[model samples]
Target: MVSTTTTSTTSSQTTRERVLACMRDFTSYQATRVALYKEFEEL
Candidate 1:
């Protein structure tokens, strides 16, 4: 039972880290996209 609990905790942390990484990547992509669009509008 203890092992199962520990395994689940580890899995949860991993999943959280994965989600955070995805969010960070998405935010970066959105910033780049906005910058490109703004540049295009200037033309």
Candidate 2:
């Protein structure tokens, strides 16, 4: 039915948002690690 389709769509949207957030977090973590390495090298 139409309601079932709508529910699935909403669920997919939530999953996509979750994936994007995880990717953002991972990217930031990598950037922080790289910065730390650079600082250590400068010392």
Candidate 3:
């Protein structure tokens, strides 16, 4: 029972980490795209 609980907790943490990483990556991509668009407009 304890092992199962530990495994569940670990999986949850891993999932959370993956979600946070994806969010960070998406945000960075948006920022880069915005910057590129602004530059294009300036040009």
List clashing residue pairs in candidate 3: none
> What TM-score does prediction 1 earn?
0.84
Candidate 3: count of backbone clashes, pairs at least 3 residues apart or interchain: 0
State the lDDT of candidate 2 residue by residue for 1-43, as single tens digits.
Answer: 2445467788888789999999999999999999999999999
- What residue runs in model 1 are displaced by over 4 Å at the alpha carbon? 1-6
Prediction 2 TM-score vs. true: 0.80
Ranking by TM-score: 1, 3, 2
Best by TM-score: 1
Q: Would you give me the overall lDDT of model 2? A: 0.90
Task: Choose 2 or 3, whichever is better by TM-score.
Answer: 3
**lDDT for each candidate structure:** 0.90, 0.90, 0.90
